[model samples]
Target: MSRFPLFAMAVLGLGLVFLYVPTLLVIATSFNESRLAGVWTGFSLRWYGELLNDRQFLNATANSLIVAGLSATAATALGTCAGLVLARHGRFRGRVLFLGLLATPLVLPEVIIGLSMLLVFVAAEQTLGWPAGRGIGTIVVAHATLAMTYIAYIVQARLTGLSRECEEAASDLGASPLRVLTAITLPMIAPAMGAGWLLAFVLSLDDLVIASFTSGPQSTTLPMVIFSAVRLGVSPKINALASVLVVMSAVCLGLAAWLQARRGGKVLPE
Candidate 1:
């Protein structure tokens, strides 16, 4: 019986290795001195240095960061408001329709979403003469649209699980609804909001399909640039860029985890 359990553990360990070994290989290959991505000649930081000097890469990075930051902020605000309405408003009319509309992007194919947004932008530019062209603004709007649904879902789940007694108590103590929301509710759900914001940021940063459709020629993102580079040939500089992004993603995730742990505190339930 113990032997069987040990065998199962071995299989599980092998599964983990299969999943993560490729990722580790990518990280290791990023330091290769050779221009070839797969063939490692020796460990070197030259690729990283070259990546820093690439103007196109730098421009793409700046564009990605700006879109991610702006879209995440807008999405978080919209999603939090939507989540609060869903959680607090009891049996409002058209709630089902509202929820379905909000969740459409989550279930819809990315290709469909990108195409639809692109068409809409084209239509608007032709008819209304507004947003005369597609660029960063278009990309930001597209990203924010996708991100809002995820944030709303996260926040709604968090709000549903949280205790309502605290809000009720605040209400009893002559606290206005807005006051209670700003002080008690927001503080308690801060962790969820932070998580949602980070998630939105990552989604926007990583998006290629939607950004490709929505962005103009001059506003190409990092992923688009990398994809173009990969089409030409695999370069160690690309790997180095990817390694930097991986580190950034890990740091963001770690920070979110820390915030969650701190908010929950060190106490264990008896």
Candidate 2:
């Protein structure tokens, strides 16, 4: 029994190392002076400097930020509403089927989602003569479709843990449902919403497959740029860019964690 416990711990440790050690190595190599990724010739920030000055990279970053922010906000709003209806109002006619449809994107292959969205855009352009062509709008819609599922899941979980007493109290005090929701309910679930927003943001920003299928030349996101660059060959610049992204993600996620902790250990409010 003791040997089995030791083996389990060993396996867990190995798993962690396998997952993270390479990432740490890549981060360390980003600072390496040598162009060859395998070699380290002292530490230098030259690659980082180069990345900062690269206009294409900067433009892609800006585009990514805009897309992530807009898509996440839209997704969070839609998901929050859906979650409220599902959790608080309970099951209604066709609700289960609707929820299953909503959740389909979460499990369906991303490539399929991307292709479907692309086909729809093409069809719309051909038939309705709208959208003009695919670009930022298309990407945003695709991202929002996927990201909303995450937000809905988070908000639904939050709603499940919430106490209805607060809203009841507000109603007893002559506050309307809208007023209670705008004031008490919104505040109570704000943490979960914030977390869901951040999660959506990350998902949108990191997405490559869906973006590739849906995006136009003018709307190429950071991941798309990275993918294109990598297709040519490995470059230290790519590593540098990846390190920057990893750092940004870490900082954003850390901030979200701190805020969540400060609000209370619970992901949802009561």
Candidate 3:
């Protein structure tokens, strides 16, 4: 173990530096008072103040949050059910097909998914005459579809680590299947469900391609706005926005961990 300790430590440190240095740099740049993002005149929250007052950015952020929340909720609900079925139900009919459908979105390129959604929406409007125009609802659905598979994968993996004994015991004690599901199964898998919801929320929030395809006029998301701003040039405000997102993501992960530690007591091994 001591033979190559220095080398192993060097490699680990190098990898962490490579992964985190850029993020650290971005966070530092966000506080730069200069109009240019890369230049650091002095530490200041000037850009953040500006960002807070920017109506367009705030609106886009609001849109992103709304879409992300709704999509994550929908994905969590659907994905939990799919995960339950795949993990618990044995040799169900069309299981292979169901898995194929779930896996397709995960493997498909984002551009393809976005374009396909666009085509489907256009076709639907042409035929069903519903969804008169693309907006938050369409974006929510697209994001949900894109994120659902990921949540299902997480939930299914978590379920695999769990023993079915509690559920079996509940059923043996005269609990109905529905009761077993609601009282025992769901609570036991609550940590995985929470983790899945966070994943879905982050996935939907960070998405650019799929959201762009489904978004209509006045439905721009934060990513879209950031991309457009980047096209012009990376400004201090954009850096501030990135920093805000970074902080938000960190807070979310911390919260999820805390919740898992609290709610996952004895259900699965730590």
Clashes of each: 0, 0, 0
lDDT of 1 at 150: 77
Superposed Cα deviation of residue 15, candidate 3 (Å)? 1.8
Question: In candidate 3, which residue pairs clash?
Answer: none
| Backbone clash total, candidate 1 | 0
Candidate 1 — which residues are off by over 4 angstroms? Answer: 1-8, 264-270
Query: Which of candidates 2 and 3 reaches a greater lDDT?
Result: 2
Q: Model 2: per-residue lDDT, tens digit, 190-214?
A: 9888988887888899999999999
Q: Sorted on lDDT, highest at the top, how do the candidates line up?
A: 2, 1, 3
Clashing pairs in 1: none
TM per prediction: 0.90, 0.94, 0.91
Residue-level error in angstroms, candidate 2, position 108: 0.9
- Compute the lDDT for candidate 3: 0.84
Model 3 lDDT per residue over 42-149, tens place: 989998999989999999989999998999999999998888887778997898999899888888999999999989999999999968999999999898887778
Worst 10 residues of 3 by lDDT: 261-270
For model 3 the local lDDT of residue 47 reads 88
Question: In model 2, what are the clashing residue pairs, if there are any?
Answer: none
lDDT (Cα atoms) of all candidates against the true structure? 0.85, 0.87, 0.84
Error of 1 at 139 (Å): 0.9
